[model samples]
Target: MNQLSTRTSPDTPWRLASLALAMLLSSLGTSIANVALPTLAREFAASFQAVQWVVLAYLLAVTTALVVVGRLGDQFGRRRLMLAGIGVFVLGSALAAASGSLAWLMAARVVQGLGAAVMMALSMALVGDAVPKSQSGRAMGLLGTMSAVGTALGPSLGGGLVAAFGWPAIFLATAALGLVAFAFAARHLPADARTAAPASFDLPGAALLASALAAYALAMTLPHGTPGTLRLALLLLSLVLAGAFFAVEVRSPAPLLRFALFREPGIGAGFAMAALVNVVAMTTLVVGPFHLARALGLAPAAVGLVMTAGPAVAALLGVPAGRAVDRFGSRRVLRLGLASMAAGCVGFAALPFSLGVPAYVLPLVLTTAGFAIFQAANNTAVVTAVAPERRGLVSALLTLARNLGLVTGASAMGAVFLAATGAASLAAADAAAIAKGTHVAFAVGGLLVAIAFAMTLAPVRAAAAVQGERA
Candidate 1:
């Protein structure tokens, strides 16, 4: 077996490095385009709504195709699919950089997003394949750190590139990264050994699942002031499609999603905890800027600087968090991570609003650190719990859950803040109203984390109960 995880092969680190680059580039793709939206709008003379699709198209494409691409990796080969993904990403980036119209840019983004879907889904799966079981936590942590770095780097990097070279420079830079990743992958990534079992695809299930996911994402991300009717319709459409997909999946001989996997507590709980944690985690992004600017009276640049602290903390803690999982075990680390996040949430609610920026920064750092730990542990536990052949699908599910939570959080938590402020709009809210909203939003955030912590305890208790009965 050429499994890099079990050996000290010289290529191991290089192979992992390639995978890391893939992870970084995909995450960079996600956030980089966001900063370019205003530039795109001005350049194309398009409305904010039209330019927004440049970002939305990439995200929707990634969300929709994650599962399908992961399954394809398993059916074909991770290395092969990974190489193709890098190539496609490079191609898309080049196309985007050279785009002449708004429509062309959005289309390019879709192609980029498709490649990103494959890369994001497979990177973690490849971690399981490339790294040893004992060290999977750290590997997952490294990937998580790169993801944070990429995300953190995006806005600042994009802004600089746009200013220096033009909007195209951003895409061109990503294309360059893609090339680096591809060279490493092509040279070092080992091929998968042939499986004796016949390979087949669940085409119908794939199509239905992709459609359902895209619908849900669009519904969740509808532009502000969009009619509630349209959102509701999208939601219903997603549900119906999801239901149909499941119905088809159950009857498929080679199902894209294996229902039986979720029967395992580790797999099922891992997925649920991921979504729950992210929902709470995402609130920081949704509400932090508003609170910082409105409640504390910080300038735009100051708010951006303060907001950068969260991802910075996450990036710094990523490796250590993973090491903790390796040393103390994922379950212990999971509990600790959740507890920290819960406490941070409580701090937001408990601390006096008069404490100003310190109050916010302290709790934000703590919460972000906790999130880094939880993410590493959660991903490691879930990916390791699944069978090797199934890791690709499971990894995709894990990411899919996290993305769904972010989408849900952006819409739901934004409403939670707005409602708590007792104001109709952000501009109308006073400092007192902003303070009240922060307290309510984070209190709810803390409560949600508490729920996740409890969820983790359930399986352990159930196992103990079974053991006691056996005795």
Candidate 2:
């Protein structure tokens, strides 16, 4: 395999800024669209299940395409892939804004997801490519901060836009941001030098992986009332397809995802930690708004404000956390982060027994801060673990783990909430029932975070041992 050369030096600030802007736009688009779901449902006279495809389609498309697109970036050029992705994403946003029907909107979202996948896969890789290893933790922290800001602003911005203008305005705004990002990226991002190795795209491996991911996403997205047998079948199919994907990858000379990457010390653990943190943190994204609206009687704007607390705190802490990781090492920072997150989850689970709305904010802030610390350190660790040439692939794996966790965690926690409340839908539940359901979901999330906290110990010890021997 041949290595590619980057046009920009590792110390250039322009490269980091451009990459950060692109990441913010991509993440902002997802969160903004989520805020428009109910409005879209009302405007199209569609069922909740149908309107949900707007989000689901995007996620499915992105998740399925991540690995393949990442591999393509490594083979071609990361900058080239990023520019193309931004162009496609802008186009998709324009189409979504002009959509005439629910079906058209969902299809456009799938396009957006594809473009987002390309951007997501390459953003961190590009950062790693441009920044020195010693400074990577801080770079990852800054990038993570941009992501948090996007997420933080999404609900409030989307809600205001929807209330004042319409749902279409949300997409239009995103498109306008994309255009700005495109201009910045084009001017600032350096071109990648091509490798001398033969270019081989793993078509079969891509297909199998896509099938497995799509099957699993579909299974999870099915309506709560759907037949158990059908869901079972889809799950089984997903497992089979996943098995097939591994088989294909092992035989292929140039695989979409290299299995050997996982064998690197702490790489697999980093992926697991990524997934687990998202699983614990994303509960707010999926369940918090409904709890606020139905149980707490907060309007959309108020709910957005309340929900913004977590991301806001995360964004504020991100840069500092990165610097901490750079100074203290990833293992120590990671353990501290995991512990903070678990404690936050415990507090979040007990919100129903607390005084009022303000009580909820503290736990969210703590959890978000923990997320920032963990992500910055873990991302740096993952990027540094792999060879520079394979950064794109490792970045995609990290993203895949997070997306998988988002989908699975949202589905599982939603189910738990529904079952606990015994309500067909959260919107239909009374305050008491919603409170009960929220407690159950948060309790489950807390438990999962605790498990993740425990899991961090082994990897931390292993890393310490390696450093000791080297020393």
Candidate 3:
């Protein structure tokens, strides 16, 4: 196998920009679709549950395909997979824009998700490949910033597009952006060198992993009032499939995910830390809006403005945080970031007793800044820990961990809110009830983050020791 060189290439800037654009488009697809949900429901005269499949199907497809596609990129070429992904994504967007029915739209969304999986899985790995280790943190940070900015831009852009031209305009716009990304990628990305002896692909293991992830995501996405027995059955089935996947990987010549990677120093910890931070960060995205609109008596526009503050702060600080990671090393920066997040969580929990929007926004900004810092540092650590050949799988695992965290965190917090408010629907609850539920949910999220903070110490020490040995 031809190892990737450590020397900085001349085309590094353009390569990074191309990868960043891909990341932005992937993030934009997600956020933009969210804003169109209600409009889609009304247009199709479909039930909310049916309309929700649009989002759920996309998510499931992406989650299922990430690991498989990442492995493909590793074996073939990241540049090839990425270019194909963009082409497929653009095609999916066009199909979605021209869909005649809800089912067709949902199917097109699945195609979009399949394309997005390739882009997301290869994004970080491509960065690790193109950028030298010494400067990787900055590139990863920039990519993270682009992702945040894309997500932040989505709702506003989607709303505007839908209002002026209709929901189809959203898909058309995404397709246009996809075309631009494709052009940049084709012009800028370096070609992948072929391996001398490519290992056989693990088709069975891939199937097992896909099945496990799909089952779990479905269970998580099921309606709030879904039958407990049915949920339990799905959970059990997922566990069984996961166990089978593990067994297959243990024996397979080329496993879908090499379990040995986790044995690497600090890699496992980095994955855990990534998942925990996302769990806390996603709580704000999923639950905070309801609290703002219903509990705090803010208008929809006011809620959007307030929520934008956190991501905007994160976007502004992302590159600086990356620079900090490079200067101070990832461990210290990661610890500091986690500490800030914990503090922010505490502040969020206290918002019920506070006076106004400033109180809420301040804590959110703090939390998001910490998340930004943590993401850059932790991503740097995880990618750097693995070998060049394994970076694609590591990237896919990191993305999977994040998706799991987001889904699990949202579900857990939703349950907490329901329990605290003693109401079936968030909309049914009055301001006092919403406030009470928000407090409890934030408190729980804070406690989880505190645990992650403590868990991170050992990995930081391990990483420090390795760096010292190298020095």
**lDDT score for residue 191 of model 2:** 69
lDDT of 2 by residue, 1-471 (tens): 222132436536877888898889888877888778899989999988889888888888889888888888888888888999999999999999999999999999999988889888899998766665666788889989998898778877998999999999999998999998899888877668667874688999999998998999888778677898998899999999999999998998878887877766788878887888898787877778877777778888798778878888889888899889889888778878887887787777786633567657777777888889999988987877777678887898899998888888888888888898988776678888987887888889888778777776776567668775221
lDDT (Cα, tens digit) per residue for candidate 3, span 262-281: 87777887778777888888
Q: Which scores higher on TM-score, 1 or 3?
A: 1
| Residue 123 of model 2, lDDT score | 92
Error of 1 at 214 (Å): 0.7
Alpha-carbon deviation at 75 in model 3, angstroms: 1.0
Clashes of each: 0, 0, 0
- For model 3, what is the error of residue 147's alpha carbon versus the real structure, in angstroms, after optimal superposition? 0.8
Query: Per-residue lDDT of 1-471 in model 1, one digit per residue for the tens?
Result: 435557666766876788889999999999998888998999999999999999999999999989998888888888899899989999999999999999999999999999999899999998866776777888889899999999999999999999999999999999999999999989887777688664688899999999999989999999889999999999999999999999998888878887988877668888888888888888999999998998999999999999999999999998899999989888889988999999899888888779989999999988998999999999998998777788888999999999999888998899999999999898999999999998999999998898888888877776567665211
- Which of the numbered candidates is closest to the native, going by highest TM-score? 1
Worst lDDT run of 10 residues, candidate 2, spans 1-10
Q: Which pairs of residues have clashing backbones in candidate 2?
A: none
Positional deviation of 11 in candidate 1, in angstroms? 2.2
Q: Cα RMSD for candidate 3? A: 2.0
Better of 1 and 2 by lDDT: 1
**CA error at residue 54 for candidate 2, angstroms:** 2.0
Candidate 3 wrongly placed segments (more than 4 Å): 1-7, 463-471
